[model samples]
Target: MLEGLMLGLQSIVEPQHFLVLLIGVFVGFIGGALPGVSGTMLIIIVLPITYGMEPISAFILLTTIYVACVFSGMITAILFRTPGTPESVATVFDGYPMTQQGKAGQALGIAVLSSATGGMVGAIFLIFLAPVLATFALQFSAPEYFALAILGLTVVATLSGGDLIRGVIGVTIGLFIATIGMDPLSGIPRFTFESAPLLSGVDFIPILAGLFAVSEVLRRSRDDHSIKDTFQKFKTKIFDFPIIKKILTTLTRSSLLGSAIGVLPGVGATTAAMLSYSEAVRWSKHPEKFGKGAPEGIAAPESANNSAAVSAMVPLLSLGLPGGATTAVILGAFVMHGLQPGPMLFTNEPQLVYTIIISMLVINLLMIIFAKPFITIFSKIMNIPYSVMGPVILLLCVIGTFAVRNSMFDVWIMLLFGIIGFYFDRIKFPLATIILGVVLGPIAEEEFRRGLLMAGGDLSIFINRPISATLLGFALLALTLPLLKKVFSKKTQPPPVSG
Candidate 1:
């Protein structure tokens, strides 16, 4: 291990590799700070560029970009209400609120710090514990995956913000949307209505951009107030040591949880962030402060998502399994270079594997250093008036949505979802619930069917496996706790007197 680490250090310090690493990080920062351009998109765009490069250099470039992009998404989410990527969706709950309260600097500081810390922790795991964690992840079958999806969906209760019924309705709507494409098991279209484009299903990037970016623009357009006027005297500090110290517990807990979740195949940073946010709320001393600009709220999701983004590489490197879309793209890069990931790769190419892991540590530290100055610039965005900023944001959203698949159909989808998001916002429905359902619905549906097939159509398979049973039990508990609390509160209250 020490030899491998030393070899990795030697390889990364080479001028060519070091230069590519910086360039990759810079490109990723720009891409992820833009609405609708996710880390997956950035990597896909850069795929052809890596064709002639050496395998280690290509891996270093792509992985560095991947790590940096996840952290950069929070910049937009904190300064504006827009999530640069879906993984930053949870950040918007508290991050934007903090911006509104003129604490943009503080929010960005916490986000950057938490992201760096979480990323380092994940890199350490990737270095020393990748094999062990990957082995444990191998234990997950269809039933366990299904149960995990169910557990992720149960976060709707916490996301509802006291409107459980409305939250359920929102999630139902999202699930319906998710079912529009061809069924994974039957290979038949379910809700395409015979439209060819619908057969591909709604792209998540467009939906996410429309919901957060375009909807925010529409909301701001209706108001005559200027952000600068609203908070004329407000000044923000780059760091708040006291606040960081206060939220350290949440940060540590979320980082660990996110890394653990990231080891599971097909579960991405977005799910990790949502689960971390929900758990932070569950364990918080003042749960009511969540969604209201609490420091812990910003810390939890940012830390978790960044950590998850890094640790997600574990499955790909160790088990030859792509943990999420971004890692799937990385796997493609590996294949293009005539290298395959798995146990054999470790023994066959230990130097290259360790180089990638060690490069990630350096990339993460560089991100913090590179992003510190930008936080000040990003925070200044809040001072822009709605009239000027709204159109620019909408235009960016349109370009980003169109760029994804180069389809006008996706642009229309973005516009439609933008309006839908506006209405949902007006009605005070929880958008997080809908997003959770949309993201997790397909995973749950596919895994559930696969689990049933494995069990000869017996429903007991979900309960028969210990891991699956535990995850399902947790999901049920999460779903029922809110209702039980409401019922008990009502039961304990005295009857109202007649008027």
Candidate 2:
């Protein structure tokens, strides 16, 4: 094990590999700072450029971007109400509120510090546990996978942001959108409207860009609100050891929970973030203060999401199964280099696998050092006029979506989803729920179908399996608790937090 660690360190410390790591960190920070963009999108966009590079080098570059992007996303979420990616959505609840209260620097500082710590902890967990965890993950057959996917989708409960109906509506719309392409089981098209491109279904990148980036652009254009630049006057230092210690103490359990969830296939960063946020709320001394500017709200989700992002690599690196869509894309990079990930990877190329793990740790540490100066710079972007910023964002959305598949159909999809997102926003629906549904619905359907087939069409299969049963029970709680609250609670308006 020590020999493997040494080789991994040596491989990534080279000038060429280190240069890619630097580039990746730089790109990732920018991507995360930009609302509507994410670490996963950044990786997918740049993947073609790495086609000719060696497997380890390319893996290091891509994973570095992924790691840094996850952390850097909190910059935008904290400074602005806009989340840089879905993973950073929870950051905005307390982070933007902190900014509004003239503590932008402090919020940014905590997010950066906590995210870096969580990422490193998760990396360490991955290094020690990936092999053993991968063996356990192999036990997850279709039934367990489906149950886990349902459990992930249940995150809408917390993500709905105090509007349960709107959250349900958002999820329903997303699931409706997910059904727009050809039927997966049947050969016939479902909602393609006879367009050939829809046969493969709505692509994830464009839908994500449209739902988040373009819609935000359009909505912000209608508003005459200006971002307050309180950070300029706020004298706050980034390094707060006491605050870091406190955050670590509060977030350790949540971070571990997120890492465990992330190791499961089909679950993604958003779920981990949402679940951790909910758990933090549950454990908070002031539960009612959650939607308000509670520091723990910022810390818990940021830590958990970053941890989840890193731990996701475990399944991808050890087992052949892709942990999520982003990891699935990473798998393509591996295949491009004539390499396959699985048990064989352990025996055949320990150095390569170990190098990727080591690179992740290095990239996470680098993000903290690199993010402080950039956070001040990013805070300025919020002050840009909405009118001028709107078109530029629209253009980015168009370009990013088009770049995904070089398809006009995707561009159209972006516009249509943009309209849908705008309507959802106007109706007070939770857009995050919709995005989660769109992302997870397919996986849930696929795994459920496979599980049923394996169980001879027995509906009891979900209850019969131990992991499946536990996950299903958890899913039921997620789905039902809000409804129970609605039915039993008093008819009083909740206190408004600083938005």
Candidate 3:
């Protein structure tokens, strides 16, 4: 293990590899900071460029970009309520609220540090437990996947900002949004209403962009404020002892949870981040503080998403399975290089596998440095009055939404949802619940149908399998947690003092 680690270090720091790291990190930073650009998109654009490089060098470049992009995405989410990628959606819940409270520096610090920590933890797991995790991941068939999605849905209760009923309603609307377009199994359109564009379904990019970004601009137009300069407090000190101590448990738990979830093929970092945020809320003593600038809230999703992004490589490197969309693209790069990533790849090129894993860890650490100056510079955006910033943000939302498919229909959908989001906020509905419904609904539906097919519609397959059953049990726990917290708070409350 030490020899492999040393070899990876030697390979990555060589002048050519080192230069690629700088370039990759720089490109990823800009890509992720720009709303609507995803790590998958960045990697795809660079895929042709990697063709001329040695296979190992190419992978190092891609891996660096993926790691840096995932972490840097929280920049916009914290600074503005814009999630640069779907994976950072959960970050906006508390991160932007922290910005509202003049704690933008602390929020950015927590996000960056937690992301680095999570990446290191995931890299360790990949190094030490790839075989075990890959074996575990393979157990997640249709039934288990369905149960996992159910567990993810239970997060809606926690994200409600204490209004479970409004949260449920928001989610109902979101599920309807998810069911638009054709039925995956039957090839029948459900909610298109005969519209040609609706046949393709509403993409999450536009809806999410509208939900957080466009609505935010509309809201700010009502009462705009100049951004405060909080750069001095934005320390890149990775081992900030006080903040680390405050969120150590949430960070560690989320990292482990995200790493475990990321091992499953098809399950992306978004789910990991959402579930981790939910679990943090589930276990925290002050659940009500979650959506109101909680440090734990910022740390949980940031760490989880970053950790999941790294551990996602395990299946790709070990079992010839792509862990998520980005890894699927990375698999294409592997093929382009005439290298297959599976057991044989490991057996044939042990150093190569280790080098990729080690490079991921190195990149995560380097990101703190890579991101620090950028954060300092971006912090200056706070000085831009909303008068100027609002129009620019609104434009970003429209362009980002339109960039997804280069279709004006998407832009219109985003504009429509921008109004809906404004109304939802007017009524104090929790935005996270709507997002969760849209995100998890399709996963649940697809997996549930497949599980039934596997069981001849017995319905017991979900409970008959231990992993599936355990996850379902966790879902039940997630649902009842809010009630449990309410009950506990009541029981522990002292008698009201006489007026």
TM-score of each: 0.61, 0.69, 0.61
Please rank every candidate by TM-score, starting with the best. Answer: 2, 1, 3
lDDT values, one for every candidate = 0.78, 0.76, 0.79
Please write out the lDDT profile of model 2 over residues 1-499, one tens digit for every residue: 6777899999988999889889988888877777645565566567656766787878888888887888888877876687887788998999888888888778877877678767887888789887675456556788887886677667667668777777777777777877877878877788888878988888766776666567766787777656554544554456877777766655787778878877765466778888999988887778898777877888888888888899888867775545554665576567556786655676688889889889888977887788777776666665666566567667766776676678888989889878877887787666667766676677678889899999899989999999789979988987898888887674565657787
lDDT of 1 at 493: 98
Q: Which of 2 and 3 is ahead in TM-score?
A: 2
How far off is residue 298 in model 1, in Å? Answer: 11
After superposition, candidate 3 runs with Cα above 4 Å error: 1-122, 125-131, 228-360, 368-389, 426-428, 495-499
- Model 3 gets an lDDT of 0.79
Off by over 4 Å in 1: 1-132, 229-360, 375-389, 489-499
lDDT of 1 by residue, 1-499 (tens): 7787898899889999899889988877876876545676567556656766888888988998898889889987877687878789999999989888878778888888889888888888788777564456567788987887777566667567777788788778877888888877778998898988889888665676667566766776777646433322333453578997898999999999998887665567888999999999999999999999999998999999988888888867875556555675576567657886655577788878988988888988887788876555544554555566567656766776677667889989989888988888788777756666666677678889999999999999999999899988987987899999999999999999999
Rank ordering of all candidates by lDDT, starting from the highest? 3, 1, 2
Against the true structure, candidate 1 reaches a TM-score of 0.61
The lowest-lDDT stretch of 10 consecutive residues in candidate 2 is 227-236
Stretches of candidate 2 above 4 Å error? 1-11, 14-17, 34-66, 73-114, 162-169, 184-186, 225-356, 372-389, 455-462, 481-499
Best by TM-score: 2
Q: Give the clash total for candidate 2.
A: 0
Q: Cα deviation in Å at residue 230, candidate 3? A: 9.0
